[model samples]
Target: MKTRKEKTGFRIPDLSRAAGPISSIVAIAVGLMIGFIILLISNPARALEGFAWIIGGGINSAKDLGNVLYYATPIIMTGLSVAFAFRTSLFNIGASGQFIVGALGAVLVGVKCTFLGSFQWVVGLLAAMVFGAVWALIPGLLKAYNNVNEVISCIMTNYIGMYLVNWIVKSTVYHQLTNRSLPVANEANIPKLGLDKLFPGSSINGGFIIAVLICIFAYILLNKTTFGFELKACGYNRFASRYAGISEKRSIIMAMVISGAMAGIGGGLLYLAGSGKYINVEDVLAPEGFTGISVALLGMSHPIGTLFAGLFIAYITVGGSYMQLAGFVPEIIDIITATVIYFAAFALIMRNLLQRFRLRKGGERT
Candidate 1:
């Protein structure tokens, strides 16, 4: 046995050197096993088959892999959006709203404009990014100037945005308004990446390439840019950063704006890839934005990690839906995701325990 002080004195390196990877593996395994057990309780026969299908259907063909990547595109963007805000110590709970605004903006541009044939895509995407930034800036400015909590302000903005977009789509001049019924315009449609012709049934698009480039850009911005340093410093200590001549107000607003832009771009990618034209405002607020938070958390706020995290999530979502069709309830994926998040929350606690054990052994040897 060792004294309490001795047991608590282990080096940080000894505690976490191997624990990071180990914890991740453990977290994933435990989460999946728990999901399996839940499925077993719900329907054992389907459980096994569902598990098999999830693995087989998602990895059996090149096309399947393409679908996974397709789904991963938006997830990566949204994950970066959430991660960027986390670095600034801001919880942007309104990514959903910002995403909707971006979608609406993109659709409006895509439909109303007919400049260059190939250039229309760029214009629509740019419109989405700019509008999304402006939408998010409102909450950010309020937080910075009025001492409003971003979390609350963002949530309110989500509802307001939803209603406003719905009104615009249903009543504005852009409304289809045909003889009997109105439909979204054809020009506003995002063309498939020719994957439909090549693969025959895939929804993969150029958005995948854009997503990868954005991830690289985000990584560079966060790790290599002066703006990132200022944002991070403000997050760590606003007072200290201010004393150091960094403007907290500016950093906060800028951080949120960038975050909003990333999210907006994600929404544009989503719309351009599929989902046809903006059907309804309600359709815009899918759980992807909320799921982005999980991606950010699981990735530990690292850009590289976010890419993998997004892929993993996309795998489970697409694969999980297949599993549901096969027999097992799709909710199993939700259970697994929740379990993983729960375990992730305790990473610090586990590190402390491992440190204590290492210290005790070292003390005994001494």
Candidate 2:
């Protein structure tokens, strides 16, 4: 909760604030324990090797680590989107919709606008934020004024965005025979920022840097500003916040809009990064958005914590892809992830237990 601390960079500063990180670590450990049980049943012989990879795959090489960063980039944004809205007691479930719309905005700009060098990505990214904000605005307005349930509106908007963007791609920028949007313009592609040299031909790009900066920004916004104070007050109790003269409606709307804009920028950063992946006519929701929910939960909706959670999730995904080496189905990774989510519920329990034990130990020492 924003009430937990004031402006203080990344440090937790106490055991009380350490609960979130401790819970996340517990979740990971429990998830891995479940994974081991599954592996024991499936293939006891190769289980150890597979588990080893799951834990250490990201560091196998520079390329592997780069892949982790590439995967983390979008989710980091999406995670922040979810976290930011949550701080204001709003659920921005439309991040998927915002993400797709943002992707569409970037694609449109990439195809139509021509900017010099890296600035193209800048323009496209801004367009994405605008598109995403616009897409989320109606839902925010409905939640603010009409008292509509934000989750329902957000879900409906998500599907609408997905279908609408798919249609636009098919009609405007569909790559012939590829079934995907056309490649972004050369200028629109995200700069390597010298990472290409380090990873030596990986998907790593400037997006990672942007994601980190944004996470820090989110931290600052939530902890250091008067505006953030109002949002958090609203989140803690809208009735009390309203009584205190904080306009709950305006805070809710602004929170949703900001959350959506973050998601949109994430989509732009990802597609514009020159990854082979592109938006297509698929009816499927953007996986990155949903994955962000898990990341937010794992991080307990903390910006700095989300960074580690995103990276951890991305790391496991890369490691999971290599499960075939141990003669296991790669889908096992999904099972592990699901189990992790399931285990995430226990994080609070673990935290409570830790708290009790710590108190008891203190009492004894006293």
Among these predictions, the greatest TM-score belongs to 2
Candidate 1 lDDT by residue in tens digits, 86-171:
87899988887888777777766666676646677787788889978988999899988998999999888887877777777666
| Candidate 2 residue 24 C-alpha distance from true site, Å | 1.2
Q: What's each prediction's TM-score?
A: 0.87, 0.93
Clashes of 1: 0
Residue 195 CA error for candidate 1 (Å)? Answer: 5.5
Worst 10 residues of 2 by lDDT: 1-10
Can you list the residue pairs that collide in candidate 2?
none
Q: State the lDDT at 40 in candidate 2.
A: 84
- Candidate 2 residue lDDT tens string, 1-366: 234444444443356476767676777777888888888899999899998888888888899999999999999899989989887888888899999999899888987787555578889999999998888898999988998999999999999999999999999989878788988888898888999889975799989999999999999999999999999898888898999999998988888888999999999989898887688777899989998888887777888888988998899999988777898887887787777778877765676677678878878998
Error of 1 at 141 (Å): 0.6
Residue 242 displacement (Å), model 1: 0.6
Measured on C-alpha atoms, candidate 2 has an lDDT of 0.86
Model 2, which residues run further than 4 Å from truth? 1-15, 115-118
